[model samples]
Target: MTATTSPRVGDEIGPLEVRATTLEDLVRWAGAIDDYSPIHFDPAAARDRGLPGVVVNGPWKAALLSRLLTDWLGESGTVTGLRCEYRRPDVVGGTVRARGVVSAVTRDGAYECVACEVWIEDGAGERTVVGTATLRTRRPETGGAPPADGHGRAALIGDRLRDALRVGAEAGRFTYRVEAGDLARFVHAVGGRPPAETVGTHVPPEAPPTYYAVLDPVERRELQLEELLDELPFAKTGGGNAFNEVEYERPIRVGDVLTVVTTYEEPYERDGRAGRLLFRVRRNDVFDADGHLVARSRMGHVLAYDLDRVAGR
Candidate 1:
């Protein structure tokens, strides 16, 4: 836990015990995040929707992954990148644990970094979320070092990203009218720490942390917008999600209508242990009614359709 613990390959992160989540917990999270989906709050509504019960929010599990890495690295380390795949939905009122194992340690520029394979498990011990994380920590006595001219390497990455861009090309834009009901559903979905001296009745000021999931423009009309993916020449019928990241500038409010713009970024191929893998990156920008930028997301998808084709080429 110190600044120089020097995490090695195969080091354990935790069985960080988190208690069973309850209805009140869900409600509180809903209020805190502004996610009030009835499936997370109204059992009848969930049943009507053919769900097992009120479903736990996917982002809640993602946040738990972040907490696991942060707790393991301590104050001295900084989490540089995190990638998560929501494999399965954890039901409400279930006890879940966050766990991880160090996978590798290497140097990047001035920072020594540790990479971990992390997961969250339900009471039944089934993994609900699986992902990888990268944290920058103090250098170890010996390890793989980054190449010289770190700044040049950074510029190279920027160049690669630029090479992937389609000049003046933009994905179709979509809009979401923020509603009070939507806010309630989102808040209830991400149950978090409740406020002290709980009051029975009041309105919250901001939307839940992951409410941007609702603002995703691609879901509006799948087939029409999916043409964007075709631009990348994916091998299979559809590619699987590799990772997703969201950074927010400010909280979205109840009445702020959001306009979302999607742009396809560069697609790059890298050689992997399995074979050659292609990664496609997309960017989503969210702006409020007044045109103020509010949130940004970068989504990465791994294309495996023509795995054999990319391999050894």
Candidate 2:
């Protein structure tokens, strides 16, 4: 059988414009997702909390990375996995760039490529988000391949678990404030109309469905991962990988304060024909200012150590 060939490692692929982060951007992001976190909008609450200012949400960063990969590979490639380490809090109103580099091309009669990405500091030359992604070419004719075994499945499942655990452990006690203008812009960008609750007008006092992006429970865990990666010492180790998979729970509205807390759930390991694999899981709990439970998030992650290199024989 002839092996499929793909792009070489270190291929540039293409350049992606990292959208600038702004107060308006954050608000729109929150509004689009229906989140009402004070930290995302309310400057006073942010100052009270001692952050430089309102911070961008974490999942948004993941989305940005996903956007980059999807754009580059077009619609034909399948995203096998993604992992992210939110290395720093990206303050609103700063320029950021998303960059990717092909790291490896492997074929066992099928072609696959691994790429690394980062949301780099546009002006300061720092990296705020680090990620790794795996993609398989969309060749439809290559049928009847062996099923991915315990090792492959563990890698996929473990990455999600780790993300859930990290979010659960660090997202609680974090706060965000959202402002009015922020809401307006986000609604506009996502093609959403202002709701009565959001515009403070003569409509029913209910939040628009889209506003939950700001206050959704998963948002808390999303933000927590950003904070954790920003502080992780291993973040600078430079060759580790990152990925993400996200799901939204419910809608959020304006004028709501969000409180997030995350917990590390569990870890598992498995052996495969290729090598050994490790997986981790996390859970996040979200709440409103009134202390009502809002949402929950679970995430997983997988780590693969290069056994040949580690053996040093």
Candidate 3:
């Protein structure tokens, strides 16, 4: 779809109501992501933990928000960044509608991007997840104004940023078997609500695109997904997920042992109205047990901290 055809500010997506009928859906997700927190599948276990009924996975809800944006953006657009905070849980057998509304649109280089306010509402209209997203639609040959270069603000930590970019030169890798429990935990973790009657020998549900982020934290921690900023020698004030985009070559199913290798591109500096922005782009290559590509995830993080303390007297 062309830019004109895509959703613009104030557009609403849907009342896409979804439900989880039995434990099968939750169990399936548990197996997919290898998380058996029990709180997800076992009602007794959940109450034992001092919770209500089965608590939907936070990751699942976040993914649903992504789904809402992607569906609205259509085939020509991409949901570049999705940031959400889990406010509550949608218990088992509960139904909710995924919804989105375009909040703003701005031109980023050659891309006309859409920013949106997204959320999930229960059958009774209570919000369980809330956040904002940034999506990009393809632009015609006629591009917008050239990207800004810091709005003329002094590049305060210019020298410090240069030295910090090279802190981590090596990428990290991890491997794991895609068990049933893994997927189930991952599914609910991201608030996956498969069809109520979806059961059978048909291929099990695939984990959410962002599910891989939690697979193997032990080995991944050393490389710290957020370490790029810590590597910088500056007093960091604020920074977070600018956006995340995942492309799946094929579905990941149960019993498929997978290997993931994470690598980062050089930290590039951009001048934004806020300050000198350094974006760290991290890419992950996921391969099935046979080494065939399963999916790829690109996460963009920004470093735009106040430098007054360090730059000032």
Q: Please, what is the TM-score per model?
A: 0.44, 0.42, 0.44
- Mark the regions of model 2 whose C-alpha exceeds 4 Å error after superposition: 1-5, 108-110, 139-313
- The residue-by-residue lDDT of candidate 3 on 1-313, one tens digit each, is 2334545678886646676534776776666565668899889999998887987777777767777766555555688898888888888788867888889888877778888888888878899988888888876433234246763222323444433333245367788788776576456445554533334424346765566665533223545544334544455556667777788887767777888777676677777766767787777778887789988877678877555555222
The candidate that wins on lDDT is: 1
lDDT of all predictions: 0.71, 0.57, 0.68
Q: Any runs in candidate 1 off by more than 4 Å, and if so which?
A: 139-313
Q: Give model 1's TM-score versus the native structure.
A: 0.44
Model 3 TM:
0.44
Q: Can you write out model 2's per-residue Cα lDDT over 1-313, one digit (the tens) per residue? A: 1123345677764445555677777776875777767888887887788878877777777787777777666544667788888888777776666777888767645455555544544547677888788877654344243356653322223355466445335634555544555556556445555454446433323444545444434443344333322222221212222333334454455555667565665566575443455444555466777787766655555554444442322
Higher-ranked by lDDT: 1 or 3: 1
Return the lDDT, model 3, position 275.
Answer: 71
Flag regions of model 3 displaced more than 4 Å: 1-4, 140-313
Whole-model lDDT, candidate 2?
A: 0.57
Report the number of clashing residue pairs per model: 17, 62, 32
